[model samples]
Target chain A: MSVQHVKIVKNVLAGNDQTAERNRARFNAAGVLAVNVIAAPGAGKTSLIVKTMAALGARARVGVIEGDIAGSIDTEKVLAAGACDAVQINTGGNCHLEAGMVQRALDDLDLDRLDIVFVENVGNLVCPTHWALGEQLKLCLPSTAEGHDKPIKYPEIFAVSDVIVLNKIDLSELVDFDRDFFYKAVRALNSHAPIFEISCRTGAGLSAWADWLLNQHPHLDTKTERLHHLSGAPGM
Target chain B: MHELSIASYLLESVEAQAQELGAQRVLAINLVAGERAGIVDDALQFSFDLLTPETLAEGAHINVRRTFMRFHCAPCDCEYSPKVGNFSCPDCGAVGQLTADGTELLIESIEIET
Candidate 1:
């Protein structure tokens, strides 16, 4: 048998990325800010969602997409937390949430009615970084209890995150979490992402976070236009 | 594991290409992965081995080439390979912006016996 060398170069992630761009267009058309919330399991993701909804109360209409491996528990929690709408995605043992999953969840949500949607990714730090869910912002939540070495170990997430929230700061003293070491590690990888230190239990430092989130919500006309521009629509 | 799913995708791609080219057997696959691509090489290889049995790619060799994350400073017009954690530009001290060099997971070529 003779060996035939057929040259075919292709990206493994191209399919997922195409779907992600489609999801992004849908979000842009609806003028909703989609935030991908990523962290390890039990890092106060649910509590932060609850506190964020409470903090943004009466100002903006918020929705949520909860991604878990098997249960709809977090979806129920967010709904109870007064989210305008919530949809749960069970990954069925997958370690991360891909764009295709989020695309399906968006179909269940009333995109036109909501101003912001938080996509709570499955609780794995490494795998989730590889997939883009068409979000305008990527939020990395690492609790102080998880220790300051998270950035050192998971540099990919820190480098790509738009914002980093150090949750469970109330337990910092108890855990001996070194703030200086954490900041140094994070800054080394990502210089622009704003790091927020907050205790979800006490609601401390949430006002600033809420204010920043509110400011990030794009105006309707500008958002649509900008998205159209980015997507290269026929007319400007 | 996500690697299992990724391996499945890779298999699908290989099968499709093999069918299109009308190749009888797949000898090997050339793959490229970047440091921040979120794929563990050993796990990917294990998944590939698990999934390729009794297929055209069964007993095929998957040769993976790993790449590191590289950054560039726009103002300084220089590109630098970051040392694991630090991404700042060395000379100008400007915040290094990530380029498209790394974070790639691609199937470069396939060797088939016809």
Candidate 2:
């Protein structure tokens, strides 16, 4: 029997990537900015989203796709907050939401009418990082109680994130989190992404985080910003 | 968890590639798994062994190799491969940026016959 060797140096997720591109194109056509939020369980990802919405006030309309292993608790919470386009995706048992999963969720919603769609990935640090959900921005939440070692412990997730939020900052003094050490560790993996320290409970420092979130979508520039520049004002 | 799905994608990709080339049988397939990819080698192998029986890669041998994480050291002006949980460079001890070589999940090759 004659056998031949073929060189196929292609990613195993080539098919997945193709599907993600389709999702990206669809999102672009609908003019929706999708951000994928990843973190471990109890990292307060949902609370952050809610506070972000509250911080944005009436200036922005937010859409959420909450991914959980079983319950629709997060969906209920966000919907009660008056988000018009909230969708709950129960992974059933999957630890992450793949690109195809996000694609299906997009089909069910009128993403065109919303300004931002945040896909709260299933609360697994490791699995969720590997799957790209066609998101333009990726936010990783590492709470103060989770310790500073998390960046080094889960380097892959931290390194891949576009923005890192140090949640539970109100408990930062209570918890023994080393701010200097955490900054150094996170910079080692991702030197470019800005790390925001905020507390969802007290609503302190959420304004800066909200500004960053709004700045992510170039199309969402406020009229005040445009007028300020037109009037030759220094800055806000 | 995701490894099982990755394993299925691997099989489907190689089988489709082989069939596109009009290859009748597959002898072996090679995969490169990154240390940071969070995939279990044994689990991926188990999936391959269980699912390939009805396809062109039914009896194909699966080989998975793990690669080290690559870190760019700006001060050192070079790149160093480091193990997970330790980002320090062996020589200069500087960890600047992370390269994607370690998270790669690729189908390196497949052996087949016409």
Candidate 3:
């Protein structure tokens, strides 16, 4: 037998990326704004979604894809709160949600009737940052209770996020959270992501975030509008 | 971690390439991963060893090459590798944009017995 060295230069995640692109196309065709919300557990991901739904009211029909290691509790909570429809994905021990799981979850929702879809990724700061779920925006929610050093500890997630939400601002003083330190750490890794300080419990600073979300909706009425939306897409 | 899935994909790529080359058994796989690739090397090796049994790559060895995350400071017109997990430029203290330099996870080559 002869020993041979075969060159096979390829990305391991290319398959998942292709599926993500396909999912993006599907969302675009249906004219739905998809946002992937990621954070650590107890970081107020579900709270933020419920609050956003309440703020949106009848303006948009929203659907949710709740990802967890094992439970449908979040799906039920969103449906009770105001989501038009919801789907739950139990990863069966996986720490992150892949594009294939999102693709399957999309089948359960009526994309034509929905205007927005929120994918609550399994609470993780590391693994989920590597997988693309074909989201138009990636929102990172870090609570004040978690401390200000999260950006320094989990720089990849902060760097990849399109928007950063500092939740639990109401407890900022109680926790002694240093705002300057947090902002500086985040800026070190990502200078462009807009940071929003909001208290989900008190509904403070929700309107600004809601308005920003509304502006991101691709009201694809004409060719010019489509181009305008594409031009403003984050990380595109 | 997601290293199991990554290992599965890596094995699939090796098997496809090995089959195309008409190889009987794979001897080793050379992989290049960046520091931010989000994979633990030990976990990947464990997954590979667990999955490679009874396959063409049953006894294959995995060789990993690590790359550091590099960035280009546009204002300073220079490229530099930031300190681990800190992406700001060392010289100017500016948030430099990432270059294509370090975000690669490529299957560089495979050593096989034909």
Candidate 4:
């Protein structure tokens, strides 16, 4: 038995990170701010996004990409909430959405007409964090129903999230959830990411979140011109 | 399980590495799994066995190095490993305000036979 060794070092393809880069560039070029919202099942991701859309509707033109293993309920909700456009992605049995899926969804959206695009990922805390969908901001919604120890258990997700939404705050008193412990866990994983405790059901603390989101909108006026030039190019 | 998908990626990475090194087969693959990664080693091994047949990593031994959750206390500046269900800082009596070190998932190295 002979032995040989070779090296072809690479990161696993949790998702198409390179394509995500391209998507980011495209979003930037088109003056669009894309945000990826991730959470576990029943974490109130849909409700929060709907609330966010409602809050931002008066100021920003919002679009949404709804990802799920099956069903279009969330997509319907987003569209009905007055989003400029809503694209539904059914991933079959896949646990999360990848950059490719978002890129494909973009084909159905008019980037010029929108100021912000929200990609609501499939409801899986572990898998969704590993996959980047070319969003400028990544938001993780951890509901009180899941308890405060979630940030401790899933540090990577919390660490990578630009913003952490402590959803279902209205139920915090009823549940055995600790607010101090949640803050501490989040601080440990990420000291910089802002934590927003909001209840989509009661519309508490959502305005602050919407205001912060507006602040993060990429400089679209410059990108819009750049994209206009690119669109005019012969090959493009 | 997501570990199945991870195992598939691991097999592909190991096989590619083995082929590049002119190795006939991969003998063992070592991985470091963090306690909080939510990956089950037994499930990963089961999936690896199912996925590695006819590949360079076929029948290879899967060695998983597990690490427990560690926390750093801000008040005492002490680093301590937390016990299950007790997420408090051992030195300062502070609620474990620090992050756990056990969420890592990586392929450390592989041993192969030419």
User: Interface RMSD of the predictions, in order shown?
Assistant: 2.6, 1.8, 2.1, 3.5
TM-score of chain B alone in model 4:
0.89
B10-102 per-residue lDDT for model 4 (tens digits): 777777678778788888887778776667888888989999888888898878788776777777887888765555686667754546477
Q: How well is candidate 4 docked (DockQ)?
A: 0.40
Listed per model, the TM-scores of chain A against the true chain A are: 0.92, 0.91, 0.92, 0.90
- Candidate 1 lDDT over B1-114, as tens digits, reads 579878887898898898898888999999998877877778888998899998888877888888887777788898888764455688887656666676779999999988
Q: Where does model 2 exceed 4 Å of error?
A: A221-236, B92-95
The prediction achieving the highest lDDT against the true structure is: 3
Tell me the deviation in Å of residue A21 in model 2: 1.0
> Each model's C-alpha lDDT?
0.87, 0.85, 0.87, 0.81
Model 4 chain B — which ten-residue stretch has the worst lDDT? B95-104
Candidate 4: list runs displaced more than 4 Å: A5-10, A13-16, A220-236, B95-103
Error of 2 at B3 (Å): 0.3
Off by over 4 Å in 3: A220-236, B71-78, B84-100
Tens-place lDDT digits, model 2, residues B20-72: 98888988888888888888888887888888887898888878888977788
Candidate 4 residue lDDT tens string, A46-120: 888889988876677789999999999998998888888999999997888878899899899999878899899
Query: Per-residue CA lDDT of candidate 3, range A111-197, in tens?
Result: 876778999999989889988999999999999999988987887788788999999999999999999888877876687899999
Q: Can you tell me the CAPRI class of model 2?
A: medium
Structure candidate 1, residue pairs in collision? none
